[model samples]
Target: MYEKVINASYDPIFIADKDGYGIKMNEAYTRVTGITEDQLIGRHLKDVVKDGIISESVSLKVLKEKKQVTIIQHVNGKELLVTGNPIFDDKGNVSHIVTNLRNISALKSLEAELSRTKELANKYLQEIKIYQKKEDMISHEGVIANSRQMLNVINLVQKITPFNSTVLLLGESGVGKEVIANLIQKWSTRSNKPFIKVNCAAIPKELIESELFGYEKGAFTGADSRGRPGLFEQAHTGTIFLDEIGEMPLQLQGKLLRVLQEFEVTRIGGRRTIKIDVRVISATNKDLESLVKRGEFREDLYYRLNIIPIKIPPLRKRQEDIPLLANYFLDQANQKYHLNKQLTDDALLAMKAYAWPGNVREMQNLIERLVITTEADDITASHLPFSNQTAFVPQPIQKKMKEVLQDIEREMILKAISEYKTTRKAAEVLGISQSALVKKMQRLGI
Candidate 1:
């Protein structure tokens, strides 16, 4: 009956003799630890896992001191809560020591959720304190925008900053998603903790898992030099911004979902599970709902992340803000290049009239180009590149219109690559920004 109960219990149940040898362990324990019964049967508890404290010392302490020792551990990507105590024999001596392990993956996830909640609460309290004392909360420059669309986005951000809910920022290329995430962190209670960003699309398919969640040394070929920390682990007490999360390979999606659910990360090839207090704010340009229905993305993970969704309208959608955005960028250009600047009505109109595929970021570069390439503060239509006389003509009237679009896109990408030496650069060339580029890549499934 006792053996049956141990076997039936969902908690990893095991019996270790006074000598610290495992006398028995149920299937749950084996599954959670990934240490088979065959290997651990006659072995000492220390051999179970390197970081596990179930060594002879812990066993001895429990046997001699007659007290319970509870420890949290990581095993096979799961968090485990283990309680060890001495089991006395008929002679009233410690003959066997029993260890009750509860797979705390669920508990750890809850704790992580609670930690994020508490962090937001603390951030609000701190913000209130700062407001009460200083009378203002300064917005960081790289992170602020007065573009009417961006203004609305910022207002929403302020409203949501006090909560730990997962935020998914969506938009066309060039809008600064990372900047928004940084703003979120700046207002978060976990501001003092690390803020790690992982570009799911940036990492090679083979390395994405190890990069985001880390791996045990020798877990796979080309592992990190010292088993480096993963994005989730590095974020520890702070936030992890998962950029282009839609590009994350299907295989790793389940693992990421587990991390979100369990609030603990198990390193590859390593037995210890580490608890984390990370607020996950994921951004992607991909339509996850479509992916879910198509069976390409996990429904559970989507539901978890879709807790809060904020869409960043593409630059073209918010054309009213172009004038302000251009002027602000011109100011930045002047400060950086020491060039006095002004945009002529025709020049500004041309820019305003141009369908800004790249958004605010594209306009910024256009201003900078007008600043450096032109010789005057007053940049006219002639200074603008897209305002070329031929640009206004519809491509369908030309031969191979479809081909022309591809060629245009290809040329722009290549030019950006040549200029920026990266996809991030190419995205900039197309008038969208980096995170926006990430979205395009996800959309293109690139």
Candidate 2:
């Protein structure tokens, strides 16, 4: 029965020695890894699977813990959930790692099929407008913004909501990227269509293809019984939000780039390519420029999706919007808690001064806490929570010769002053004779 379970499992199973040598592999492993049982046996496990790109600490832990660990692996163009477990000897020490690799590329195919069903359901729904608006979460009823930057974002979304163009939201994590994405879809022409979301970072690399463009049954072993539709097919005439687009593996980047260019997709092990009319919108908080320069992300793909770039300025950059967002939350709390929620001027000021590394999302969580904890409607500065009082950081500007010289001078003076207690100490800190430092300082007009 145990052997039957192992053989019947859909996921690939591998047993490797402590040093990373494969001792045994299941049939599923052969189908995905392309390494036959005989060939895999006694081979270096990591060598056979280069896509894993594991660190030394991982191997050590697997051996030491005598426990199990799961890793999301992207090899070639396939995605797999590889779970490794330590095998113990008579002394209870870990001897080998019995790992299971489940190829979920096919699962994504299933998701695509499921998505089509969702679209068909949409077509038959009553009050299509109301249902679509709710489905896409279009209303800004719950969102709150006080700062000019947040206001600008609200304004931009309001502007684009009436249009049918592809939208790209750029910002850091915990910045309500999804909130903005939902708002865009809720107000777009395809609101009646499925607002399918695909997180590029969450999906396994190998499975990204199937997740994006599904696969046919028997296209590969462990696939669903019925060949499934891809996300493109599921989102036909609808909208698909590709979040964390930067984490997509390079090989799949080509596939995604192709879909964006041709507006079509083909399934794995399928004969014909399927044409799709879905509007493609993507969001990312990554340094895509650096990725492109390093040959990590495709440049062509970047230009294609960046058509309607909506820069969701980080909360730190747009500090002015915090109060509005806070009030929106307070109104929400009033409705929920049946209490008149309010904040004092000092409290509001304190919130405005803190550095929001997590952005709007972080702010939201903090406000919720304040709403639940505070007693007074008019919350005071003492009621507010913050580690320090600092305004937003200034964005970097690429200036020409004059600004560069001034920046250089400012940095030197600041560093010198900081290192020393006074101007004399600062002069000494520069390491030049005091007279030379004074002369240079005068010349630079510092």
Candidate 3:
């Protein structure tokens, strides 16, 4: 029964006496090593090694060392992992040594396959990074960042999108801070997750808390009977954009700070907390540092949200991008309204000269308005509405010098008329006759 049990094992087994003479062998030994029973049953292990049946003898090492031994033995062009464990008699003398052998070629093949798989995985990761970089360079969602400042901003957005850190966007109103937030979400790993946008300034102070952290059923008057999840809850496992974050209430800012610290929120009328995984992005035109100094904003929350700050440059500073933006908006408006309105060189030059106080938003709206309202195919400098004389100052050495001068004259006459109520008073201020003023106004389509 013991011999049958030992023969049942898949691995080859050999039993040797104390002096290292082989005493018995399992059927697997003959089947795996292709050695006949007579070759090893009565032979000493050292003689087996000398016969070249095996390159080494683990049983002989076990007898010499008086302990277990292991080695790789080459037999019939195959590698065997052989381990010999000694059995001691009552007198602590070696009674026998039992050796077990297993083939290791398949394990080596599996290790090679795993190494190739790791290499392929790394190659795919590098390729994905290159593809993502190219995608970031192409504009999305009306974002045309041609200036060096805006390009740097885009690059920073790309670098930080992989992380879950909070981002604070600082810029003047209409500088497209919201657009940058959208791009951040679009490029992130959570792109398929929910995206919730809330304007802190738009909501009333009394309801802002409930609008952010949710409430239980019947928590307040006019509350829904079944209760509702707030914007933060709805944005779980995704991103939340807090627009105009500076306008958030002071009392509620403490709760927001808690949420940021704990990654959990308690409803207005419930004690239970709901855990969330959300990436926060905030935007504010107001100066948060000034607000903090005045004690109007929470200092801790400000620092928490400002982990990564991106300040978008206003339109006036990046005037070089004005022409590109103007043409882009023009094309967009034309496509939407199915109109063929085109801006002439004088019109573009005048636009670039004027300071766009309202930034990209104002430019986009104005272009759409021009496309809809202008009747002629070509919109010239005379058709522009920048009526301030200082803003329409003539530039030196221009292709359309005559048109530029005419625009300046029109701006001056309009300013004078706006300051002095009557046309007669405006003409006197301009040192021109009323008839000449009116004729020039008509000619310039003022």
* Among all candidates shown, the one with the greatest lDDT: 3
Give per-residue CA lDDT, model 3, range 271-340, as digits (tens): 8999999999999998999999999999999999999999998786676678888988999999998888
The per-prediction tally of clashing pairs is 9, 15, 0
Clashing residue pairs in candidate 1, if any? Answer: 74-273, 109-262, 173-432, 173-436, 174-432, 174-433, 216-268, 358-431, 358-432
lDDT of each: 0.74, 0.72, 0.86
> TM-score rank, highest first?
3, 1, 2
Arranged by lDDT, best first: 3, 1, 2
Give lDDT: candidate 2, residue 242.
92
TM-score of each: 0.56, 0.54, 0.58
Better of 1 and 3 by lDDT: 3
Give the per-residue lDDT digits (tens) of candidate 1, residues 316-336: 455456666777788889889
lDDT of 2 by residue, 1-446 (tens): 76677678777777778787767667887778565765557666566555343322233447756688777766547777677778788998788787877667877888899999988887777568778565334226455554556667778888988766777788788777788888788778878888789998998888888878999888988889799998889999888999998898888888788888888888999878889998877889887888899999999988888888887776645555666667767677667777787876556656655556677777777777778888777766667554232332333442355644543454465446544757788876766677776776666544
Worst 10 residues of 3 by lDDT: 390-399
> What ranges in model 3 sit over 4 Å off?
1-138, 387-446
lDDT of 3 at 421: 68
Worst 10-residue lDDT window for candidate 2 reads: 387-396
Positional deviation of 280 in candidate 3, in angstroms? 0.2
